[model samples]
Target: MGQKSGGYDLNLFANPPNCNFVCSVCHGVLKRPVRLTCSHIFCKNCILQWLARQKTCPCCRKQVKRRSLVYVNKLRKAIGRLEVKCKNAEAGCLATCPLAHRRRHQDSCPFEQMACPNDGCSMRVQRWALAEHRRYCQHSAQWHCPLGWLQ
Candidate 1:
């Protein structure tokens, strides 16, 4: 999902498909994902640090190759796996979900999402990305790591 300089071209992420992979950390379904050259998928930061420390695929424990790691695009995957609902709990949003339901859910899930409060970090990521956010937020006194830690 690299972007060109002229303008934001999100063509690669124009769509998504449904999926499920074990959370690399807790082995949960909810860990955010990324694809590796081995075709194995794992949570974003999970594999990064996993690679940093292990340098092997979390799934197969094989040596990870170069730059093949990338985030699993939610919008792209939602097309197949997501089930849409009205998202309004009280309204009983039983409208029957569509493939494009994730972005809406991220914006609507009462218990699944939250926006980063960093003054300029405009990311509305899942709860896990919060630790990644706070580590790099310019406004947070506790921001650490030599790297900015954004992905």
Candidate 2:
């Protein structure tokens, strides 16, 4: 909720979301939406930041206050049910997950990025490819000793 950006990228969604689910301020899918006195909804952070500069609704220019804003739980649940593409989609990940489960999918995503373990190797490779990468890495130990120690 403390995210600098108030919402999600629209393009991340598997299908276009309803217009009401979009924040008029940041122009993205509403995240933690809050409804104003004027019946307009905006992302919580977007409205709060707007109130900081001007105490008027961005949609209808109606006078509003921080105390008048209401958290919209139903809207939040609906948005969470929407499907989204994986952040690593371009990295050969073909997973589409519920918005609420995005973090869970990322946690186990085989294509998730990981830095090389070898010293002096600055390469970043997917988790599924790390073993192959480590085997060929120039910075890795050259050979294994008979006593099972790296030589």
Q: Which numbered prediction scores highest in TM-score against the true structure?
A: 2
lDDT of 1 by residue, 61-121 (tens): 7788648777667623633354444434343333445434545654645444567887766
Runs in model 2 deviating more than 4 A are 1-4, 141-151
Against the hidden true structure, what lDDT does model 1 obtain? 0.53
Tens digits of lDDT, candidate 2, 1-151: 3356679989899999999898989989999999998999999988898899999999889899799999999999999999999999998899999999999999989999999988899999999999888877778877444466675
* Decoy 1 TM-score against native: 0.38
| Lowest summed lDDT window (length 10), candidate 1 | 1-10
Off by over 4 Å in 1: 1-20, 30-32, 70-81, 84-151
Local lDDT at 98 for model 1? 46
Candidate lDDT scores, in order, read 0.53, 0.90
Q: What lDDT would candidate 2 get against the real structure?
A: 0.90
Clash pairs detected, candidate 2: none
